[model samples]
Target chain A: MKWSELFTSSVGKKWIMGLTGIFLVLFLIVHVGLNACIFAMDGGVMFNKAAHFMGSNAVPRILEIGLFAGILLHIVQGWSLELSNRAARKKGYAIPMGNKGSKWYSRSMGLLGTLLFLFLVMHIAHFWVPSRITGLDPVLIDGKEFHNLYGEMLQLFQGNLLVVILYVLGCFALAWHLLHGFQSAFRTLGLTNNRYLILVEGAGALFSILVPLVFALMPISMYMGWIK
Target chain B: MQHYNMNLTLKVWRQKNAADKGHFETYPVKNISSEMSFLEMIDVLNEQLIKEGKEPIAFDHDCREGICGMCSMYINGRPHGPWQHNTTCQLHMRAYQDGDTIVVEPWRANAFPVVKDLMVDRSAFDRIIQAGGYISVNTGNAVDANATPIEKDKADDAFAAAACIGCGACVAACKNSSAMLFVGAKVSHLALLPQGSPERKSRAVNMVAQMDKEGFGACTNTGACEAVCPKGISIENIARLNREYMMAGLTEDK
Candidate 1:
């Protein structure tokens, strides 16, 4: 097989999707951990500092380009898979098999991923764009100035119930997406042993639930005035 | 053991030939014995059709005991009927109740086109196997089975993968109609064995190339194939195949 087949062949495309999906998940881990700082409730002191460090740093600044590229590749590859898979079966069954053969989310990854993409757009517009490009209002802590992405979270979540609800809904979509995707990325990478798979699945389930739960809690806490 | 008869409403797919646009024809079957296999019920329906001077429904079946993997029917939206770990030939009529309406169709993937009625041309599988499903060995007297000194765990895993009967259920069951499970099973079965070591890399590379050439969709790891597999082949083999493909495809010296 030619080297170009890596992006063309079925297995090759999947390999790329798996590699990139896992890379994105690793980004999620960092994002979730940093976002958890909001729960500190110290007027976004630790949270703002960390967010400022990540945005200003040379390494992460460069890595952000790769992150965007990875996301685009994942979405493009996902679209092709969805289209070809739809074409594979030219006709529908007289009766549908709903969640009989696999989990609804597992088969519906295409839908779930689409929802996540929309959510990501809103999320990026809400935070990533202002923090990185347009520049957010600066707050001073310990005589140092930091772009207040955390303050934006606090104000937005408290002000708009609809946005908060959408954010929560987006988190729900993320949970379902991760539920299948976390371990699925590994499976696509060919980690088949039951011993190791048990660990991967456990971690995946925990990550799927905890990351979204904590992320959702941030908006809910701010909206409900739980956080200062 | 109790036996009973039930009448059923059968909606069967009928296609005259490869070029023909097919449609479903409903036939009401009477006195279907609960004890009879699903294929036997179809046989009864075919007999009735012959008596009525109508064309019989065409289906593929051989070695009715189920090992041949010849039976291919999407009964009531499942690859085989509702029975778990069962072939269409092994699916007994008892799975359905009286007055049930069962819709049967041929395997609906581009690669496995309808030959006629419920039978499909599965020679695409043969082509994939021909690409690299086998390992080369010199023909001679049989060596002792234990001469290879295979690990018990690896041997068990290989044997489990070998249980795949080359049936198209995996392809039929997958929403993507991916042949990954089928190819994975073949790849895993051979890749796990000592004899399979020689062609392991090329086998993964070539079989996947042929599978793609045949126009099958990619696997999404939904495990639909694993769920509907009559032999209960696991998707773990698919993971193994992915690993094999990645390693073989990337590191090839040529």
Candidate 2:
């Protein structure tokens, strides 16, 4: 069975969506936790130490691979589905209008997904790739050769108002994706009962809002010199 | 609390039959109650139409309850009109004003063809359902609901999936005219139960196949299905369907 033939199938595309979506959710958790370290360390020595450790760790490297796969699969599957849907609609030109009753997010997943993917590219280029490839100075924290990753991040944040705005917009796009994505992801994975669902939805909404809000604020805070 | 009669205007889609051309017909309805359900207000208007030597507009309805999902119409560009969860039949006249103009139309989807006026053929949904939705549980072999004693979590999940009224609101709400939410709800309903275990492999495949066969667009994972579903059916079902389908292929004894 060729991979393309398999993935192009209706069922195959769904698997790709779920697998990548769940992986991205996991990535979001790790990313959020790592970013939270900035608040604890106040964007200084402690933050730099943590960021250095993350960039140098084997686990982060492995997760980055998964992250790349998740991004690719998510985007490709979404676009493919959109294309297929468009083809089907074209075939049925004379069909009567059925019920129109979904929310803006559900219908716009592809567009939002595209925006999120674009943001991912910018994010990796600005942060992840730079942290990896650029041989920036190693900081001295408690007599150890710590990487000044946080300092480097602060440099990126400083006076780059356009970048800050783009990052903020990216967060907003990610939040919109998750607002619908989180609940739908639960439904996709067979967890759609009321007891857990209500709780899951609440958690999904909170996490979605909180995670992006916190990240988006970091750029603003850096620009304000609140965390130098 | 005093009651008063008020005049209203209606622009209703009218088709004599499936073969006839349809058009919006207007009528004046009087003495509407704020407490009356939205459907009851329509009943008043229809009665007037009948009395004025005109044919009453035909619409789909059953149960008059939110659960049956038989009542569906776009009121002023919104599915099921102003209220969020309630069906069009369950909507109250108080949601509108004395002189408000109401534009009522049938659910608009390529798969859901109009049978007449406001009653579209939702049988496309039926075909999707018929396509291997249930497990091979025979009628006589019915075990006690308590016998299986499914994990509380699983049972709750099944119940949530079961809440879908097949109302087609998700389809109406989707911009791409996708039926992912609707197909997802049915898949989730049976997939969570022990009764559905034996045939879970084929269930996802068949349902998705049937969905495509019926000319419904694929799920884009956009999250609109969950937003517009009156039952708030999750996109998780689509995810589950994906998982189930994958498991089926992997487990095939090839």
Candidate 3:
């Protein structure tokens, strides 16, 4: 098949989904790792240091461009696939068998992904845009100036119940999305060996739950005054 | 099996042609013996319609024993009807209770436009098969069966994959109307044997290319295809197809 056809074809769209999906999974690991620094509970010193390094580093900055491109490609490809799939089934069954044919989450990827996209927009507005563009309040760590993103997170989460709720809900959607997508991405990439497939599924299940739980906990912990 | 008689009201789809607007036409079928196959019951209905100077409902069926895979009908929102692991032709009237109202319709998919009534053009499946569904070998006397040793388990797996009858049930049953299960069966069947190794990579790539060109939807691993498959073909073949495609993409020369 030609390179152009690869993107145009249904199976090729799937390959794109799987590739970008796995890339985003890797990004989540780094993101969660950075966010987990708040557990130190030291007035954002360690957290701010890590955040500043990630924001300023040249390698991470270059990869950030690719990450945005990947996200855009994933969204475009996903919505196109969803729309075409819907169009393929012009009529629906009168007696709809919802869960009998497939798992709810597997069929609901489009909805979950849209929710995640909205959450990402809000997330970027809350921190990424302010810190990277308009800039944020700086704090001195080790006699050097850095953006106090941890302080920003604390201020954002402590008093705003609605934002906290939205963050947690965003994590909720993320968990469900990953529950199906984690293993599905690998399966699309042809990881079909029985033994390793089982292991991948087990690990995917754990990752889906744990990563989102930690993300949800960050805002919840801040709102409850546990992280102060 | 003991035979029993029953009455049924069937709401069957009726389309004059590819461009005609189809609608359900209800017909009463009485004294249907429990031992009669579903197609045979339809045969009775057609006979009655013809006697009444009405156009009989058009449906596709051949090799009434179910091996031909020519029978394609959606009964109560399921491909090949409600019975498990059986084609519509193999389905007996015994599965239905007396005075049942069964709704029968043609397979719905953009790629498979309805020809008339319960018959849809399944040439897309044929095109996919034509893309690379064969192994090229020099014409000669058949080689000894034992010349190339194949593992027992591998042979069994290959046989299972080879059981796909080119039926479009998997596509009809899929929510996305995806043909991955069908394509997977073909890919896995050939990829398992030594005779198919030479063109394995291109076969996977070209067949998938044709499947997409046919306008089938993407697979979401619903397992509906496996459930409705008369041959009980597993979704594991889909996984193998995915593996084969990815490997081909990686190894193929630019």
Q: Candidate 1's error at A166, in angstroms? A: 0.7
How do the residues A126-224 of candidate 3 rate in per-residue lDDT, one tens digit apiece?
A: 999998999999899889998989889989999899999999999999999999999888777777556678888898999999999999999999999
Model 2 residue A199 CA deviation in Å: 5.2
Per-residue lDDT of candidate 2, residues B1-254 (tens digit)? 45555678888888777777777778778888888887888888778778888777778888887789999887877778767666898888878778988888877777887788888888988888788866675568767779877898888888888888899977765555677777767777788887888777777767777777787775655555575567777667766676676676667454
Best by DockQ: 1
TM-score per candidate: 0.97, 0.71, 0.93
DockQ for every model comes to 0.75, 0.20, 0.50
lDDT per residue as tens, model 1, A43-148: 8999999998898899988999999999999999998889988898786677666677899999889999999999999999999889878989989999988898
By lDDT, is 1 or 3 better?
1
Candidate no. 3 TM-score: 0.93
Instruction: Considering chain A alone, report the TM-score of candidate 3 relative to the true chain A.
Output: 0.97
> What DockQ class does candidate 2 belong to?
incorrect
Worst 10 residues of 3 chain B by lDDT: B245-254
CA shift at B148, candidate 1, in angstroms?
2.6
Consecutive 10-residue window with the lowest summed lDDT within model 1 chain A: A91-100
Give lDDT tens digits, candidate 1, residues B1-254: 67899999999999999999999999999999999999999999999999999999999999999799999999888898898899999999888889999999998899999899988999999999999999887798767878989999999999999999988999988888899999999999999998898899999999999999898899999988998999999899999999999899888887
